[model samples]
Target: MKYIVTALICFIILVLISSCRNDFGFTSSTGSLKFSQDTIYLDTVFSTIGSSTRTFKVYNRSNDDIVIPRVALAQGTNSKYRISVDGVPGQVFENVELLAKDSMFVFVETTVDIMDFTGDTEFLYEDTIEFDSGANLQKVALVTLIKDAVFLFPERDAEGIEETILLGTEEDGVRISGFFLDDNELIFTNEKPYVIYGFAGVPPNKTLAINPGARIHFHSQSGIIVARDGTLKVNGALSTTEELENEVIFEGDRLEPLYDDVAGQWAAIWLTAGSINHEINYATIKNASVGIIMDSFNNASNGATLKINNSKVFNSSNTALLGTTASIEATNSIFHNSGQSAVVARLGGDYNFNNCTISNYWNGSFRQDPTLLISNAIPNTEFTADLTAANFTNCIIYGDRNLELALLDDGTSTFNFKFENSLLRFNDSSNSFDGIPAYDFSNINLYNQCILNVDPLFEEVAAFKLRIDNTGGANGIGDPASVTATDISGTTRSTSTVSGEGPDAGSFESSDLSGS
Candidate 1:
C-alpha cells in the first residue's frame, strides 16, 4: 500500500509541473538583493537653487535576513552636496534589516547652497552603498538637486540674442555651426524646403519662433542643432498651406500600410540645448535622423518643459522626440517610429505626453531604437550626459511587435525620468522582418502606472490607415479612462465617430465625410 501511494504521488506531481511553459521555467530561488533604482538625478542650476528629495528601494531575495551596515554617499574626496538621511547622516540607520523576500526603502535628501554656487553648471556626484558579499542588499541612487542659477545660460541674460544670416544661402547640406543671439529674435523662413546641414544659432534668453508653411528639411551630410539656453516657439495651423503641402495623402480602398517613398530618410527638425522652453504646436515633423534632440549640456533645460502640442512626428532612424528640459507636455500629437525611440528622456527630462498615438511599422515596418541607456558615469571631463525627468499620460504606444522598443542612455547632464498612466501595445508585432525584443528599460529612471501587453486592434496598420474597429473587440490601451469623452486639451467625440465597429483611439481624428 505504501509503494502504490508513492507512485501515485509522483504521477500527480509530474502532471502539475507539465502544465507550465518550459521556456520561461525557473527552478531556483535568487540569493541576491534587487534594487529598484540604480541611478538618481540631482539637476538643479544656479537660477533655481533649493533642497531636493529622492527615494530608493531595496529587496532581499535571500532566504536569510540581511543587514545593511552603512547607507551613505561614497563621494570620492571632494564633495559638493550635503546629503543626509532623515535630516542628518548621523540619524541614519546603522543596521538596516530586511527579511527574506521582503523590501526596505531609503530616502535621501540633498540641499544646495546658492551662495557657494559660483559656476553656472554643477555636477551630480555618484553615491554608493557598501555591503557584505553574502548578505543581500540593493542600492538605490536617490538623487536630488538644488540650483540657484540656470546652467544652460550661465553668462548670458535675457537681453542678449540677435539673429544672424550667414551668407544669405550657403552650400546645400552645409552646416551653419554655432551661431549666437542675444536680446533679439531669430527667424528661418524660406520659400521652399531648405536643407540646413548645420544650425541656426540662438542664445539662452532669446525667443525664436518659426512661421507656418515654412518647410525646413535637413541635408544628409549635415544636421541642424541648437545650443543650450535657447528658446524655440514653432506655430503651425491646420489651415496653413504648409499643412496641406506636407499632408499625408492616405491611399486605400480599404486600408493599406502607410507608404513613405523615403524610408529612414533624413529627418526634418533637430533641436538640442539645455534650459530653453520649447513650444511646438500644430506642426507636421517627420523624416529625419532624429526628430528633436534636447541635450542636457551646453545650452538647455525645458525638455522637461518642452511642450509639443498638436503635432505629428513620423519616420526617423533614431529617437523621434528626446528631451531633458523641465517637462514635455504634448497633447493631440502623433509619433511614428523612427529608429530605437519615439520619445526619450534623461538627466531631468520631465515629460507630459497626453492625447497621442505612437505606432511603429504602420508604414510597413515597426519603429525601433538602436541605442540603450545604461548607468551613471562622472560628467567632469570624461563622459557626456543625457539625464532626464519624464511624465507620460493619456497616450497610445503601439509596437507592430517589433523587436526594438526604447532605451535611455547616459546623460552628461542631470537625471530624473517618470512615466505616468498611459497605454502601451505590442510594438514588436512585425517579428520576422524588423522585430527586436522590447528595448532594455533598466536605463529609464522611474516608470509609474503605465500599461503594457495591450491590443489596440488597428485596422490593418500595415496599410497605414486607421479606424476604430466596431465589430471587432474593444482595443484596450491600458486604461480607457485616460481619455474620457474628452481629452486633456478638451477635444470631444461621439460613438458615431466610430463606424463598422470602428472608433478612433488616439487624441486626433481625421474629418468624417460619411456623416454616419
Candidate 2:
C-alpha cells in the first residue's frame, strides 16, 4: 500500500509540471524562432519618398508558444526605417507572442533624406532588427542612392501657401501657377542636374536656354512651360568625338534602371500660345505624360512654333508630340513608344517631318491609338478645328498596330496630308483605312510615293535603335534631295545600288553599308 501511494504522488507531480508549462509563457531562449528571410533587401528608393512596404514572417518552430522579450531596431528610434509588428507600428516592441505552429508578420518601410547622409550621389543605410536581448538578430539591408538635383519649387509664404499666376490668356485662360524662373535662373548648364517640383514657367518675352550636356529631371507631374512670347532654346549639340555624349537629357528624377522605361512620371514641355522661335536640337526627351505640347497659337509671321532637329522623343504615356492647331517642323528625329500616338496633330495644325522615324511598339499597356494621328476635331467634344497641313517626306511611320496612321476629318474643315517617299505600316484587312475617305490610301494625292506594310528592319527594337539594316527595304528608297545629308547621329545615309544614290527612309543611317 505504501508503494502504491508513492507512485500516485509521482503521477500528481508530473500532472502539475504539465499544467505549469501550459500556464506560463515560453521564453525565446532556445533560438528556435525562424524567419522567412534572414535579410530583407530594399532596393533603390528615392529620397523623401516612402518605400513599398515589405513583409517578413516570423515562425515559431518549437512545440511551445514563445514570447519574444524584445523586438526592436538596433538603432532604436533614431533609425530611418520604420517597422510594424502585427499591425502595431513602433520602433521597439516587447512581449511579442508567437503561438506554436503559427507565424506572425512584420512590415517594414523607410524614407531617407539624401542630403542627411554623406557619400557619393547615392547613399547606403544599414540597420538590424534584433529579437530578445540581442541574442537573435535579423538584418534588414537597406541601401539607397541619393541623387542630388537642383530643386525648383514655388515659393511659400509664412502660412506655407504657394503663389499663383495666370497661365493662359483672358479669352481661354488657365489660372495655373507654379515656380517661375527669373532672368538669372533661365539658363540650365551642365554643372548639375535640375529637378523641377512643379511647372517651371518662363516669363513672357524671356528665353530659357538649356546648354549642352544639361540633365533636366522632373518630379511627378512636373514640367517646363514656355509662357506666351517666351522661347525655349535647347542648345544641345553632338560632340565631334563622343558617340553618345553632350546631348541634353530630359527625364524623370528616378535614376534606377527599373524606371528607365516608366512613362508618365512627369508632364510635358508645354509651348504655350504666342510662344515662338522655340528649338530643340540633339536633345533626348522621354518618359513624360506628353513630350512636347504645342498649343493652338500660331504666329503666321514668325516661323513655326517649334523646330526640332536631330532629337529623340520617346516613351511618353500619352502622345509624344501633341500639336493642337500649332505649327511644328521636325527633321532627323525619332519618336516612338507612346501610349497614344507618337505624333498627334489635332484640330488642325501645320506639321512637317523630314527624314524622321516615328515608330510605336509600346507593349507596356493596352494601346488603342495609332502611331500617327491627324484629326480636325476633338473626340467627345463639340469643338472642331481645321487641320491646315501635315506633310511627311523621306520618313518611316511603322508600329505593331494594324493601322499606324489615323486621319479623322470632321468634314467641316480642311484636312490635308501627304506621305512622300516614306514607309507606312497600315493593314487594311478589315477595310478600316480604305473604307474611310480621310484614310483612303487609293488616292494617290493623299498617299503618294510611299511604301505600305513593309518592314523597316530595325537593328534593335528593344534598345530603341531604329536604325535600318543594310539589307532593309527602307535603305536607299528615300529621295536624295528630300533626305537630310546626315542622319540623326551625324552618320551619312547609305546609297542603294538598286535605287541609285539616295539615303534610307528613316532618321538613322545604317553603318553596315558603305556609300560612294
RMSD after CA superposition, every candidate: 26.1, 5.2
Off by over 4 Å in 2: 1-41, 45-47, 54-69, 95-106, 118-122, 131-138, 169-172, 239-245, 254-258, 300-302, 377-388, 410-414, 432-445, 457-473, 500-502, 510-516
True lDDT of residue 401, candidate 1: 52
What is the TM-score of candidate 2?
0.82
| Clash count per candidate | 101, 4
* Cα error, candidate 2, residue 162 (Å): 2.3
lDDT of model 2, residue 497: 38
Q: Against the hidden reference, what TM-scores do the models get?
A: 0.46, 0.82
lDDT of 2 at 108: 84
Give me the overall lDDT of model 1.
0.48
- lDDT (tens digit, per residue) of candidate 2 on 190-212: 87678888889998889999999
